[model samples]
Target: MVRRAGHLFAFLVVASTANAQMPPPTVGVIQLEAQAVPRSLVEPGRAMASAEVDIRPRVAGVVTEILYQAGRPVEAGDVLFRIEPSTYEADVRAAEADLAAARAAVKEAEAAVVRSERLLGTGTSQSTLDTARSTLEQARATLQSAEVARDLAQIDLERTSITSPITGIPGFAAVSVGDLVAANQADALATVTQLDPIDVEIWAPSARVLSLIEDISLDRVELAESITATLTLETGRAFEARGSMVATSQSVSETTGSRAARFRFENPRHILLPGMFVRADIVLGTANAILVPQSATEREPDGELTAWVVAEGRAVLRSLQEIGTHAHGWIVTEGVAAGELLAVDGLASLTPGLEVRTVPVELDEYGVVHDLRDAVAAGNVEAE
Candidate 1:
């Protein structure tokens, strides 16, 4: 009887040991999906359109007619106002008359010269020929002067029709019908802007930009001549417009260590206007970062990034790499692998070296879902 009892005790001890050695069902694990993402720290600028100008007439004569409504589109050479052309018209008529008179004088002088020459052949005094020659020269000078005056008058007349200098959408008009606009008036007829294509200006840290240029490929397929950028409008909605990095500042700003970069976007609908503030996304490069859901991570007192990994059926602690954030998750630049399993749920009671039984979890087709129960239950999900 004593021998039998001892054997039974040994058998029970062996069974318990075997059960302890077996891992408990896992709580949950979400597989990591590799996604190409960009650094999202964005800076905004009050962007101006490609061209903006106050439509000031070179020659002013305003107060006639307002051709365009404020904030209306205008075409180049479209008449915006009618300056009193009466004065210019009178000047032109006067010049024309002067020209005619000058021509008449030339004809009279030529006739006198002919008569004088006939007299000289008939033995008239040399003084007659000299007088006739002087009259012809005076007529020639007057004719040249008249022609120049007429040209000046015509130019002045043309200026009486105040016309749009450029093709653009017009802004407020300062002057109205019957208001006298002085020559070279500072007050503009209207403001015009080219809105079909606009610019987005962004500022990025100097160091980060330099690193991207060095590490990221210059000949990247998307960056043949420019960098691709996505613009977010003021309403928090992304614009359908795609922009390319067209220019960069020559030097870093001493005050902010930020340099200016410009991207060009096509604003066909005129939805974006000049001076509109917008945020932009600039893709630097693709990084092989350890990305995990936000729930599985926690911060320590020292501000270090921490994660719970299951190793050998026990909870394991790990410090995250120093890379920045990615879309919807954090990027662990180091201390992680591409194919490693990461805890996605049941992290509340996680402890180092804790036993767990893990089942596999998977994302949905849209890559937006995870089934933690599938990872933790009869498929043997549990927590230690």
Candidate 2:
């Protein structure tokens, strides 16, 4: 019995030694490469109308008709409402009659002056000729005054048709038919807002702006000739239209500590409305950046990001200085370099300086890690 127990103890000792000498854990890794990638900044924004105008009556009168439908598009000079035109029309006609009477009086006074001139050497006295000339001059003055009155009256008549001064979509009418409105009244008949080529106001931190400028100056980032923007709506759908930066505020807001940038986008479908909240991704430029897959990173308790890097056939825990996110990865600016192998899978089992066997892997479009060999065999990815 003692011999059998001793043999069993020896067999257990050999088994424990074999277990300690087992091969290291295998982990899937992807090599890091620096490439020129677009650097984008995302910020919340609001849509605003490029142009807004209030519709108001230019002449005081009772509203006779509303010529436009609420919320419909209107062009410049398009009539929006019709004021009572009968009164204005009558005034124009009266002024025209007065003008005609003034013309007749001027002609009669000139005839009298002619008669006086012809008779000046005979029965007509010199004083009579002078009086006739004075009367003709007075009549001519009256004719000029009457002509001005006629023109003024015509302008008032034209004001009866309330026309939009800009092309835009009109809001609800404030005055209805039979509602009295005053000329140049404080109340607006309606508001017209231009929607197409809408403006989006994006607020970016002033610090970030300074950083970007510094990066450009250092040649680390190549600024795009024209910065472009894209939007994500509140409903989580991507907007179809792409936009460009048009104007930027010169000063930062004291309250928000951010500067506002305006982007213009075509809103032909009227999908973007004034005051609509959205998310804007502004592409400022491209930079040579190292991209690390998000799946490879782990957030530590201290709120720092750490990832596993394979060096000398051992897993090394590295602290990454992530600048921003690109695609399904993070744009790392520090702590890792090009040609380094970053472990993408089996990260939880890894420890500092732990021996690891790295198998090359590739990240799919969605950032899911896949075996390179299997991916290439399935034709999902080309061998590299």
Candidate 3:
């Protein structure tokens, strides 16, 4: 009888151990729903001046003075440099003196002509009168020439005061005081670039942009109203003001297979500068897409993606491809169908083919938990 009791005790101990090892299979499950998302594409681009001009000399002379401070903004017609005006001024004075002399000579010739006319029938000869008249006409022609020379000299003198052709920021002066510069020199004295209302040049894929344009045309969408763009500077900060597409290339580049697109943006604060590397976020169009919560998605050992779903009262795994993110979730491009009961919480204790007690869960508009079952269901579908 004692031997029988020992065997029975051993059997009880083994049964208790087996019961302790077995874990209860239960997991929370929520119905998966597909959400529509809008998409945007980012393209590389660079900022450039909307208007740039070379500050060149109109008339060559010795640099007498520098009118503007280096690296500062200037208004249109603002004097930037001053060439020596002594030579031009001298030429003007000489022309004026020549004009005065011509006037005096004309007066003397007219008087002689009058005298010859009075003596024509007396001792004075006709040739003398003719000579006087010719001299007066010559004097008048000389005066006309001198007047033209004076006007030209004045023009030259005014050009000596070099002024900015456009309102912009002038760069450093290439030449300083007492430096001789030529009028037709290849090099420029300085450069002026417009800072506000800059342009961003982006080379986007030809096929993609063309397709977007065609889609807009087919849908009768307004190009200006439907499209929008923003700039992200090289420092990785987004610009406050938005930009708009102003112009595009007529043909695609054969080498890069992209077409050049120009966008205009207001830079009233002068934050954006020319030759800056930037990123362009172009909103092509909107489309419907399916999104799953990122928390529910798992990365497998093989670098693939997976998620647990409750199928037929057991844990099941489904493969998924997360293309991007949208509305607090991963946008699944493929795998997993709609209306499946996906396990979102308490997944650590569950494995494939394991029985799970599921509790229904709901998500709010912001992807936060809205409502959950108070008690876990005992049976597959009915609450205990």
Candidate 4:
């Protein structure tokens, strides 16, 4: 009886030890909830001027005066520079004098023709009348030629005062006072850039674009009537103004395999400058989707993404159909549902069908996980 009692005691001790060693592993899990998230694509972009015009001379002359200050805003038709107008003025005066002389000659010829017609059958011969008429016609032709010359001279005079063709800020003058410039010169006198409304050019990957199109076709994404874009500067600051999609390339680039998209933004303050680098967030629409923390996912050898999810108190590895990444996680379209517990920690130790002791946890904006109890204690969440 004593030997049997000792044997029973040893059996009980071994069983207790086995039970203590085989307890389920603890894991931190976060419950996923399907919610509307903005379907957005982020791409690197560069800011460009909406309208950039080169200020060039329309007439040839020596620049006499600089009417506009460099780097100043100018309105359309505002005189920017003044060429030497003396030669143009003199040409106009000569043309006017010639026109006046031609007019007088025409009047004399008309009088002679009248006289010849009045006396054609009396004293004036037929040949004489024809000569007077021909002379009158010649005088009239001279008058018309003089009139054209006068108008052209006046146009040249007007062009001597170079004016801005657009409303924008002008750069430094390429020519100083007394510098000679020619009409339609190859070198620009200055550059005027429109800054009130600027353009940002973005190149998005073809794969991303195709995925978006697929999502739209399947009704997974609700397309906005007007797509919106926002920008982040190189300094990590958000641009104050919002933008809209203006145009997109029809063909993808062979080198980069990306399509170019242009967006327009109101830049009343002129904060965005040409050639400035930025990151653009183009929000196409919103969709009801699930976001799985990246830390909870693992990439298999077959190039598939898998995550450990708690199902019926056991770890079940699920394959996720992810479209892209958002915030700090993967934007999953399928293979997960709302109210499912996703294991965020202890993923390496988790195996299929293994019993798991799940503890409620939450991810911060940076995707770092924290225990629910600790979060509550730290006032990060309200106690439930």
Taking all chains together, each candidate's TM-score versus the true structure is 0.70, 0.82, 0.62, 0.82
Candidate 3 lDDT (Cα, whole model)? 0.79
Q: Candidate 4 lDDT, tens digit per residue, 1-384?
A: 999999999999999999989979888888899988788999999999999999888899899998888777999999999999999999999999999999999999999999999998899999999999999999999999999999999999999998888899999999999999999999999999998899999999999899899998997888899988999998999999999999999999999999999999999888999999999999989888998888889889998999999998999999998877788888888999999989998888888999988877888999898878776678876532
For every candidate structure, what is the RMSD over all alpha carbons to the true structure, in angstroms? 6.9, 4.2, 8.1, 4.6
Native-referenced Cα lDDT, model 4? 0.91
Q: What's the distance in Å from true for residue 143, model 4?
A: 5.9
Model 2 deviation from native, Cα RMSD in Å: 4.2
Model 1 Cα lDDT, one tens digit per residue, 271-379: 8888888888776545655566556678889998788777766778788754556555776665666666677666777778888766566545443446656445555
Worst 10-residue lDDT window for candidate 2 reads 375-384
Which residue pairs show backbone clashes in model 2?
Answer: none
Query: Candidate 3 residues 221-271, lDDT tens each?
Result: 224455567988888999998888888789988999998888898998889
Flag the better candidate by lDDT, 1 or 4. 4
Count clashes in each candidate, considering only residues at least 3 apart in sequence or on different chains: 10, 0, 1, 0
- Misplaced by over 4 Å in model 3 are 1-39, 95-148, 218-222, 284-384
**Candidate with more favorable, higher TM-score: 1 or 2:** 2
The Cα RMSD of model 4 versus the native structure comes to 4.6
